[model samples]
Target: MISMFDSDVVSAELLADIVSVSKATLLKWEKSGRLIPSQNSITHRKEYKVSQLIQFEEVRNMINSNWDQELNVKPAKDFSSVELFAGAGGLALGLEKAGFNAVALNELDEDACKTLQGNHSQWNVIQGDVKNVDFAKFIDVDLVSGGFPCQAFSYAGEKLGFEDTRGTLFFEFSRAVKEIRPKVFLGENVRGLLNHDNGKTLSVIKSIISDLGYTLIEPKVLKALFYRVPQKRERLFFVGIRNDLVKFAKFQWPSPYYRILVLKDALKAGELYATDVPKSEGQSYPNRKREILSYIPQGGYWRDLPDDLQREYMQGSYFLSGGKTGMARRLSWDEPSLTLTCSPAQKQTERCHPEETRPLTIREYARIQTFPDEWHFSGSVSSQYKQIGNAVPVNLAYAVGRSIIALLNSIDAEVDLGSDSLAFNGSFHSRQLTLLNT
Candidate 1:
């Protein structure tokens, strides 16, 4: 096995993709001498040795974790959650493990709804758009959660109101929370949402959330890597408390896992898994893509291609300044995976397996997201990928769920002294409660 310390060279496009930065930013870094670019003799294109990234504090921490300690925290109270945009139940399943019984799960995609229903027939999987659902049915649910799509709003008026965001899915999320009036609400979105539109969009979201009678805690972008998932995906989380409950609503975000998980831990029988990843249907690359990817090494991308092939594969993008690292990329077993996109073998964001030259299989994809082996996905292979790729990593959601449960437990005991609460080990706790099992 090649050590992660082995000097890695990648194109500007790949580095940009890795850090979610722009090529213009790379140039800015270069100008500031924060980044030094090297030329690939063949393409004469600039590449950067990954030595700087390797020595980076965060990267170093990722590669050198014990990852040996396992934490499966349980809930402090038997809370119920109503999930919107519940894709294939990744977040739902993890939250269930943390002890939130899902009373209802609403999804727009039929395949994703079936995937949820197929796995857990008892779940009330409501199929169709968020706009159609009457969330009033789930009244007084402990929590309402969803990974709503982000949309830009018109700032035509001086202030953005809850109604101003009417056309966007986020508006639907806010609407559901308004109707259900849950004690707590969790909204998830892509990390880009944190800074979308010069921060105006997030500011508007915060304003709308506040206007809806909830106290919006400052949103945080949680990195999946820190939460025991073997991937580098980032999701922005917004936790809000019902206005009346804000004083006592102490919501602590979940703690990071003991160590970072890697692809090996995910796919093999190790810390994150009890058995090898099960074989299943998957997307395959065409002969040309397969042939092209064969030349790349584990953790390598298009820059690893031969000069002519680099030009051939990249074409016009070859001349483009960005590294486009997702193209013809293969993951390294020793490190956490780059985020999995909807289409694994798509031209711009391929997720080829480490040892094999094809895209990751369905089960492999699930494992990387920390889904249990017995959990079955129902849909065409492509639809399955869409479900899994778009999901919050199971382990990440579990960590968040645990924290939410802790907060709810505290409130239950404080507000109603007779309430039964869950102990750290899943048993009952006392009225004066300690939050996390920390």
Candidate 2:
């Protein structure tokens, strides 16, 4: 990713943003010798010299990013893709921006289908359970993509293959690939899958990818914050090439954008949005809850409330272990928003406005997800929130989409595999792509 990281020094805040971690985690890395800042600034703040930080993988990638060149890339021909589990069109729209045309989109939710149809009348959206849909008709589509829900397999003390994963959403996705036989396919899911079932789940998935006659790229979670998205959302992406094309195709993960966007960019008129977030329907707390939340400051949570209020608000959760940082939480304008959930005001994941004492409005949620203001939703307020919250940030998808396009371009031009042109990751400012979701 071509980001603007020209300075010789990197601040603690900037480094933390680039690495997709908290400042405290940086401190922990320092203590463990995993990361060490070269020196402090004139104001006595921790600062890292970029030259000395190249020992880190993320830093090295950033310093050698080629995001600007990637952005200028275009399709060698009209490329088409079939998207499964196309929730609310976030991924489809992003891929559209990155130069892929949607041949067909499959969605199970009627509302999400309508959202996609209303926004893009030209799209062929098929609404129904994917089990009933056949992909054999859409042949040679170039690419197939899906954000399939992560489900564990029934392990039998043996390695699993394609049929072993029957009855799961992932199987349906694999079935699509089996039928369409696209040159490439992309799968996305929560980062937690990296360790689900103690890593056996991922192991089985690897087996299935191989069984499907594709070569799986080493998957990585890309952080939205580094992709010009103003929310701390992350999604794990898996890109694979058809076995026949594996010898010729080179797939590189997208590099990170230079800057980290925060809540202020999402809600106010700035780089991310052309205007302040438009007022709309949103969830509200009862009088007592609002009163209690008002006591919390921007970036503070229930712990910041008075002791009595904390007991009243947290109830049994108060006695629970772990930080429970999401409780009674108020967002900070200067920082990216906490990962949003299906509902904005759940007791376990309270995301109050940075200044206002209310949950984020539907429009605000869309803004944080980097959905354009004009891309209207087609559901009740609650459904809209769920759709927006569940979406891949449009910008994040766009960034990855660019990299996918680059890979396709390389394959089409029959570019030399020995050249850096097929790098898994090109030069960046040493502070680029790894998305995280909560």
Candidate 3:
């Protein structure tokens, strides 16, 4: 048997560099059974043993070399998109960057709906429950997109179908996909969806998409921080292509940006924007809370405070294990903001300004998510933050949009190559099924 700890233990940072993956990705892999790290019994800190590293040739190769390259390219063509659950338009705006025109957007929240319409008057903003809408009405669309909420399916039999999933938001999303039958569709959701109900939810989702006559790509969880957005947000993205088109194309995930964007870049006039984040309505901590937080330095948290202050601030949570890094946290200008919760002022996930003693304003939240400055959010300041927090980062969406366009372009190429001839034959349906299965 091979020794699991033949060499010295390596820190996660070094291991990430050695493996050519982000620290977060390495951690997620550990959690997902892809990798296992040895733990120091006394300190309870994780470390990758050198013996374990030697087991993976890929990591050993990266550890022995150092090289970085960047790619620059433009979209081949301008594609069109119809988005559902368009919160604060983060994904919508990103798709726009990939050269996709937003033809229609649908969201149930009155404020988010208003936000979408207010910013882009040309867009058809439909505000209501998705169940009430008829997506088939929109024809000739190139892409259909949504960050649809994931809900458990009522499994009546071994396999789930379109009708069996009724009453769930995913059903509406699938309904739209079935009705519109666009060239491609993109679905985004929280990473938890993968393990929800012990992964049954995702399994059913895959089944339904397959049954609906689309080719489901291997679902992937994309981290926003890796894609240039400064936040540590992760979302599961599902890509589906029309059955007839899958065999004709290959799709690649977007490459990560060379440098990470940090809090300063978001709020200050820098690479992310031309000017500092515009002053706008922001939530403030109470006088007592503000005084307590004043003691924390930029990037510091409750642990930096005196014992008395830490006790008072953390209260019951102080006794709990695991780093509650969010408590009394003063965000560092050099790092990405922790995932923004719907409520910025929430005690568990406080996203305070680096210099100031206040919650990030609605505009700052939008900016962090990469929503263009010109984009306007509607409803109360609180509602606006909720919409922004719940959204997919715009840049991530753009990257995914580019991938969709590439897939579509590949399909077009195949058509030109005589791979998809328009001949009415008994084999057409079977060929479509075969393409989808691939």
Best by TM-score: 2
In candidate 2, how many Å is residue 172 off?
A: 0.3
Using lDDT as the measure, what is the rank order of every candidate, best first? 2, 1, 3
- Candidate 2 — worst ten consecutive residues by lDDT sum? 429-438
Off by over 4 Å in 3: 1-78, 419-438
Better of 2 and 3 by TM-score: 2
lDDT of candidate 1 over 248-297, digit per residue (tens): 66677776553556789888998878888888888888899799899998
Go through the candidates in order and give the C-alpha RMSD of each one to the true structure: 7.4, 8.4, 7.2
Q: What are the lDDT figures for the candidates, one per model?
A: 0.82, 0.84, 0.78
CA deviation > 4 Å runs, candidate 2: 1-17, 20-24, 28-60, 156-160, 415-438
Residue-wise lDDT of candidate 2 within 18-47, one digit each (tens)? 666788898998899776676653545677
- Candidate 3, residue 293: lDDT: 90
Off by over 4 Å in 1: 1-73, 156-160, 417-438
**C-alpha lDDT (0 to 100) for residue 159 of candidate 1:** 81
Clashing pairs in 3: none
The global Cα lDDT (0 to 1) of model 3 is 0.78
